[model samples]
Target: MRTSNYDKFPFVPVAKAEACQTGWAAIGAALRAALPAHATPGQPLVLAVECYPGTALGPLRQALTEALHPALCLVADDLYRAPADLDALVAGPLTDDPVFGRLNGLTVRDFLDPQKMQVAQATLAAATGQLVLVLGTGATLVCPSPTVLVYADLARWEIQLRQRRGDIANLGSDNFAEKASLKYKRAYFVDWRAADRLKKQTLPRADFLLDTNDPAAPKLIAGADLRAALAATVRRPFRVVPFFDPGPWGGQWMREHLDLPDGPPNYAWGFDCVLEENSLLLGFGAARVEIPSLDLVFAHPRELLGEAVHGRFGTEFPIRFDFLDTVGGGNLSLQVHPLTEYAFDKFGLSYTQDESYYMLDAAPGATVYLGLKEGAKLPAMLADLQRAQDDPAAPFLAAEYINEFPAHRHDHFLIPAGTIHCSGAGGMVLEISATPYIFTFKLWDWARLGLDGQPRPIHLAHGAANIQPDRTTAWVQQHLVNQVQEVARGEGWREERTGLHEREFIETRRHWFTGPVPHDTLGGVQVLNLVQGAEAVVESPTGAFEPYVVHYAETFIVPAAVGAYTIRPHGPAVGTECATMKAYVRT
Candidate 1:
């Protein structure tokens, strides 16, 4: 790799501790501090040991060391382990220090084989139910045995129902892909209501308009189509906070991108896909922000994202939330996204680039390309990149970037405007961003090809110009929060105000009243939904709190825009979907 005026070594340029959360954050901070200023087989991003949660760790770390990076292996926990095989890391390095003890009077390499990897996984997955491992590093531990269930791309939702007895179905197969070595686990997607209690609702006028590019196209922007698209729902008095399976894609995703020396379908950790908004379209201010599904809003990840559009709106549509389950670790460019000014000046675009990450998994030693490789000389760095474009034996800037980040798990970096960064491969990371599409400026790539069978294009120059050349680290340290609101809480039963959420259209909270309330009291229609273990009765602004869970806990769009109806939770009850939005707030 050649570049003009680049600096090297003396890593610890900035500390990320201020933005950290728990002890893991501290450990994350420490590990980042010790990373080598440059990466080689010998000196890399990972410099110290990191103890992850619940991992038998020692053996896993040894295996990872054999397969991935020894710099990242955690030695805090122990199992009878094999000798560290530098052969896998560096093919011909002579013995320096014996990292692990010998066994059977021979090197542990003589004893360990590929079969042992499978046995270790089976033991871990079974013992550690609800989790699995990725091939090399990290674990997809939350969702287990989730076989293949493909969703038609761009359709908002897909539903499969079984109305009669013995109406059987399956969500994923029993066999796994990749190695084609692991057998599949059988499971079906079904609702758990008794036959007698299950009401045969007409699936509620559901429809989907396939819109991938723009969000404001009348079909997706608002009106009947929007209401109809939201037909998929978890019913009243439900259990387990009904989750979206995101099936098949999980297994297939792991196999393709994560296949490595470790093996596939290794269930590790999972971060919930949070947030719902037209974030991809970065400019022109999105029309309506869907508030009903604001349950997806992980939090106000940033301080500024068009504050005008965030508060009360007397006109226009409501605030909305959107979701994306990305594959091939993109947002992958370690480029600084152009700011509103840069884009407007250059690309005639507008927006800011600030996104929060909810890390689903991080294979061991996955360090993020957080900053420059220390003491980086600016002029030399620029010249070398230019030279690469003209030379053959030289690596491109993007190639150098891939050589940089080894991003780990549960890591949240505040990607403010002008930060050059990227998430590495493996794991599902949920990106919550400002409601614009054009926040990113591509800097580097691992030279990964797209579905188009070509290396994805990069914008290193644009990204370079926008880079915020500052020394800072950690999420919490960068952004300060004055008040942290507990959204909602309860185990068996719940009934209370669900904190607060305000953006243009409506201010929402859990509204429950036992006795009678006047009609058109609040002066808007409210949509009340029953989520779990709760029975609610609504006296139609003019009527009484009805006696059923059918229309009771179900979502009933209050037609009157200026009325208050009485609400009461019966029998150890709680309501999850009990809030309203603008078009919804006035019901």
Candidate 2:
């Protein structure tokens, strides 16, 4: 593979005056200086440090205590209900299922004990002539209106890494030894939902925004500066920081092509534009402060995702672009997503995951399993899947029941909800889909152990309920595979409509150009990936925003506020054919 030129740590420069402070001492000093302005004479000053679920509160409280020498320091965890009681409260949302759980509408206050909160309020009312510090996930519940409020945030990806290391537990429970998958499911269903609700209410009013992703090196920025950075971001094309993880069916493609580190066994998944887990870097002078990308969605949904999309999704980013690599590895497990009504009834999701696989790179003889065979019977196929899961020695015989199609470079396979599909070995796929990504129901694995040495979970019952038996080989071939047609052309550029199927709400288009290609967001956000070519540059047509450069396999977003922009081949690909596949919500 050619030498990788991927920009791993992309950041947008903020004003020099908005410099970020590094280290705990500096952060504490800044907060100390700001305390005088908000403090009342002859009264105790309360500093509330409201944290997201995965933040490391121990070190934070310790560092701040030594720096400010607070007379009373309160931990929110001490005010929460006992572990068993908290679990019982959230058991309805965190279902018994291993991988799937219902999205709950619980807020942070629901997790706190009323009696403890009442006592804490009484204590805060009595403290005088001293500095009082309250910190933790539900710290705001104890001290609602503190003299100074600091919101400590960590990205979901960083939280997952911490969970894998057994460094933290779920929000209200102390299950440090629990399986990482179960912990993730609990956080996804219960903790994140509640935390996000609190974050939406408090982030804008926070006096300071704390970056707690790094344990030893914490960064702090003024809340106004952070808000200004986000406002500046929506006027231009930007890329969120990407993260990669290894899996059982991972491959060597990303490690070799993307210049990834060699420490992991293999790279299986690359999250390019999953805003929920990614981070946005804001550069202040030489320092970079990282915050959750979802903050942008919460702060300015209407400007980032247009009026219609905001009306439909309401602060939730609906599109996701990620990579699935199987080159020089094993095949992905056969899986299907739930239908819209099924998703809402069972999982409390407003929409289902409707996705498409665009083959970024495929070795010769690469194939993808899609749809059922022409003569396949639903009962027989389901029985076979059950046998495979029941008896490890019995193989599912995937090729016999599923239709396998040749996967070539740039081939698009539309996978609306309920369509059984998987990418076989020897292919690199860019999966463009809806944001509800973790609802997949696996039907059959290849009887291999996971990276943790346990058998992968299979959801035969859920898969059976959602599978579309009518999507047979002929139907898939006619309507799903390579459904590309020319839409428009100019002197040096042409655009083609790529298939996402009529059932899907995402519309995709492929633009092949050797010169500048014009694009309009059409009153909604647009996401694009440079599928073919080495490099390209995106610029504003009216020079309203700074030019942005992207490399091959890199995904970027243009907010709805950026009405008109142009992209052209740059650097090494200036004279060669460069292609970008763009996806937008269908109006």
Candidate 3:
């Protein structure tokens, strides 16, 4: 089942894993072959579904009313929005300005009102032919016209791991600043840009799509295999799966390098290759599934980011990687980000966070603040970061307009957009840029708190309207440090060109190796990582296929239809050498 040259792009080829080993009887036989046989049983079979918010929805409404047996279901959270107007919009008034903190959260048009959208459109227009509704967040923006809609996605890292195992309680107030400020007010102000404008106005007038991101295999993707699995999931070689957060400079290097699942407290950021907050997975047979890596960049952004990065960041998955971990813990905020027409005229981001970091490990005297010193002054570093965020014991800021440096293991830095950076304490970094990773803006944090003990949110006037002040200290030691060169070598490999960043578009190179290298994906998408290896692999040149491997600091990804590959390392002896780094897109 390996054929996939993107059938000139349209999508829908997914079903392998021995025809997706039956799950919910393949979404009840894909809702009985996309319904409509003289609309049986009475006439109205609505079936909306839509979900997210601890969705068990009473065992998905008793498994779609016992797999569609004379159905009825209903319950859009008993027509929500009322629990005293969702507790006055979750205890209201959140305005530290940035346009009321990007118009803060709670939506789906404030969770379905208009008398719960006229009692869910008069219970899907006075149902008769098995109407199994059951929606939740903004009940599919006021339900009704749905002979099959089903969305049911779930991933904000599995709804913050089932809201930290309380098994999800209506996404809010599970502490951590009432669930990370209502998950940064519903992903930067109201549910994923209002579900990408209600999925470009309801997925081209929906009919049947249901993925339910692996509720034990709830797939259903219709028509031309959901457009050839969204144009061969953006050209293949996938990864996503990473997710870890905790902060205030959290550490213990991903709690001793990832095997995850132990209550947080440390793990600061690891959305490794943050494709809109990671997910992917999809195996099928022995059951796998997952989804959201912005669902293959909102269903094939020109086949998973290619048409010149989907015509310059439209479906926006312009590189990202992640992992900050101040090992054992502390330092990171003091940020900046914005720029690029000020993150698309202030936060409507179409591209901006130019990041870099790299490093990978570093401890004794780790340092790394960066850029700003030789005659630094941006209004005395914005009056010493507004007198240390209004006197939380002011002392911290005067380290003479920042600059620092030192960090070791591989050391890379770069940062670009507005320069001023962070890292410090021990280290680990990685970062890799420009996917607008939470538009940083920070502006100092050593006066610490966050991990919900409070005092965090700084964005000092959006980092003084995006800092840079000519990125001082000899413009960050001649352009953000480690500007290596070399490029191509061969015979036991060489590579080089480590992160140049003239305002990054993601370049980097690194390599080093000892035996194999070859590489290609020149059309685009690359990402790699193994920052000094223990293993490698990759493959493609006729060795029929199946290779991949990777490891040590692991990151992965190649896709641009893989083209030519081969990395091959794995050591314990045999000519040991390895290194890796890669990144891509710059061309």
Candidate 2: regions farther than 4 A off: 41-43
What lDDT would each prediction earn against the true structure? 0.30, 0.93, 0.67
- Compute each candidate's TM-score over C-alphas: 0.34, 0.99, 0.39
- Which of the numbered candidates is closest to the native, going by highest TM-score? 2
Residue 381 CA displacement from its true place in model 3, Å: 5.9
Error of 1 at 13 (Å): 54
lDDT of 2: 0.93
lDDT of 2 by residue, 300-403 (tens): 99899999999999999999999999998889999999999999999999999999999999988889999999999999999999999999889999988999
Clashing pairs in 2: none
Q: Which is the better candidate, 1 or 2, if ranked by TM-score?
A: 2
Question: Where is the poorest 10-residue window by lDDT in model 3?
Answer: 3-12
